[model samples]
Target: MPLRSALAAVLVAIIWGLNFVVIDVGLEGMPPTLFLALRFAVVIVPAIFFVPRPKSRFRDVVLIGSFMSLGQFGLLYTALAIGMPAGLASLVLQAQVVLTVVFAALALRETPTRSQVIGVAIGALGLIVVGSGRGAETPALAFFVTIAAASSWAIGNVIARRIGRSGMTSTPLAGLSLTVWSALVVPLPMLALAFALHGSDAVGFALTHLTVPQLLSTGYTAWLASLVGYGIWNTLLARHPASAVVPFTMLVPPIGMTTAWLVLGEIPTIVELGGGVMLLLGVAITTGVLGSGRRRRLRS
Candidate 1:
């Protein structure tokens, strides 16, 4: 990947990392489903009118929204509400990296390089270490639900790759347009589901009780994380292979853990710190920053 795209990936990771903490704050005094409804509601209104639709099939747009927006966030928010710590949620969601690689290989025929395979292995080990260190207070149901969320996200990543390779979009800018349009498709279904799952009365109560933290969290997630973050992310995926882009997400767990500690006072244990270092090292290898030079020398 080019340096600019690499930097863009890192930027998205940072935005998404801090996003966990924001979601935790936002869920306070709000039902998870209703909070998601509000976030997507903020994402679509007004902007949808100005942003042109992506140059892809309508079905493709719907698929992106279903998996990426609805499935991913729906499970994720519920997991957090049920007892998943924000920092651990961040780490567990990295399971999407493995899933994306599998899907990309089978669907896109984009084989992973040796370094990437190795990096993923190392990252998986780190995830195990981090998970083992999770406090007993965390619920088993939350952990499994988060795993489902990661799978949903991985499926969404594959769908995105399909869209990018379909020749439906002519340019990277079209990718951003697609992100906005697909996001527009998410809110209605999500709102309906929210009502279906958590009665209208509960939804109404949460909406009426909006606190400052909730409002700010919704705004940040809607504008910055969903709009800006996904916009650049889709653009990068359009311009690069899935293998090149997805590994950058490995950077999120450490950043998420750090932000959680600083903002929420959730201190990390020594095992988590060790796991974080391993995760970073894995990302470095996967991104070609650490091992590429040695590989090139050996090849010569």
Candidate 2:
């Protein structure tokens, strides 16, 4: 990947990493699905009307939204609400990086380079270390649900790459369009689930009692995290091979852990810290930031 795209991916990781803390704030005031529904609803409306649809088929847009937006966030928020710590959730959710690579190789025939494979392997080990050190305390159900969210996100990544490869998403607004339009499939279903699970009374109470912090959290998540973050992310996916793009997500866990420590008081264990360091090393390898420097040194 080019430096510009690589930097964009890093930016998305920072936004999304801090996003876990923000989600905690929003969930304090409302049910998970309700919060999720409102987030997507806000992503629509004025923006959707202004943004043209992606050039892909309407159903493909729906498919991307269902997995990427609805399935991913719904399960994730639910996991966080139920007891998955923000820091650990961030680390665990990176299961999607490996999942995306595997799905891309199988579905798109995009074989990863040897460095990517080695870097991903080391990153996977880091995930295991982090998970084993902290995940024992997490509720079993919440842990599994988060894994499900990762699977859904991985599938969405592959689909987005496929659409991008098809030459349909060539517009500058392609990412924004896909993000806005695909979100059309999220709100109603989430709202229905919210009513069913929480009852209309609880949902209504949460809506009326939305505090300023909660509203701010929702706005950050909707605009910055969902719209801008994902818009850039999807565009980058369209531009680069999945292997080149997905590993950058390894940065999110470290950023998420640091943010959680600062904001939520979730301190990391020694083991988790070590694992995070390994994760960074793995990302450096996979992204070839390390290798490129080595080559430059030899040439000079």
Candidate 3:
């Protein structure tokens, strides 16, 4: 990957890392399902009117929106609300990296190199260590839901790779337009889901009683995380192999853990920290940054 695209991916990681803290704070005052509804509602508004749809097929856009927006965020918010800690949630969701690689290989024929496979295995082991330390604390339902959220995000990544390969324009502006327009397809289904889960009364109550922090969380997630983060992310995926782009997401947990500590005052356990280190090392290996020089030296 180019340095610039790498930087862009890092930027998205930072934004998303902090996003868990923001969601946790937001959920303090709002119902989870309702919070999701509001976030997507903010995502698609007057802005959707201005952002032209991407040249991708309507079905592609809908699938992307459903998985990325509705499935991922909806399940994630509920998991946090139900009892998953912000720091742990961040780490667990990195499971999507493994899932993405699998889906990309099966669906897109983007086979992983041996090094990539090794890295993913290391990362999965790290996740196991982290989960062993923290698993006793989180609710079973919340834990399973978070796993489901990760699966949803992985599916979305594959769909994004598919869209990129299908010849959609991927200029930065087009990327932003795609993000916003794809988001436009989410609100109705999300709202209906929110209603089905939480009921219309709960949704109305949450909306009427919106706190400032909740509103800010909705805004940040809509504009910064969804629009800016996903826009840059989709652009990178469009230009690179899914394996190359998806490994950048491994940075998210470290950032997420740190931000959760700083903002939410949730400290990590010693075991979790060790796991985090292993996770970062795995990401470096998976991206070929950690072992590239040695590999080239051996080749020479």
Lowest lDDT 10-residue stretch of candidate 3 = 168-177
Error of 1 at 72 (Å): 1.1
Model 2 lDDT-worst window of ten: 128-137
Winner by TM-score between candidate 3 and candidate 2 = 3
Q: Which digits, one per residue and each the tens of the lDDT, describe model 2 over residues 1-300?
A: 789888998999999999999998778868999999999999997798899988999988999999999999989999999988888789778878766776777888877789868877886787667666664557878877887898899999999999998875579999999999999999999999999998999999999989888899889999999999999999998888776788778779888888988998987778867776675666667656678789999999
- Candidates in descending TM-score order: 3, 2, 1
TM-score of each: 0.89, 0.91, 0.91
Global lDDT of each candidate? 0.82, 0.86, 0.82
For 105-193, candidate 3 gives per-residue lDDT tens digits of 78888778898899888877877776666645678788778879999999999998888888765454767777877786667766787
Better of 2 and 3 by lDDT: 2
Give the residue spans of candidate 2 off by over 4 A: 113-115, 135-137, 278-300
Q: Which digits, one per residue and each the tens of the lDDT, describe model 1 over residues 37-93?
A: 788888888778878877788998888888888899999999999999898788888
Number of the top candidate by lDDT? 2
Q: Which residue ranges in model 3 land beyond 4 Å of their true spot?
A: 170-172, 296-300
Error in Å for residue 266 of model 1: 0.8
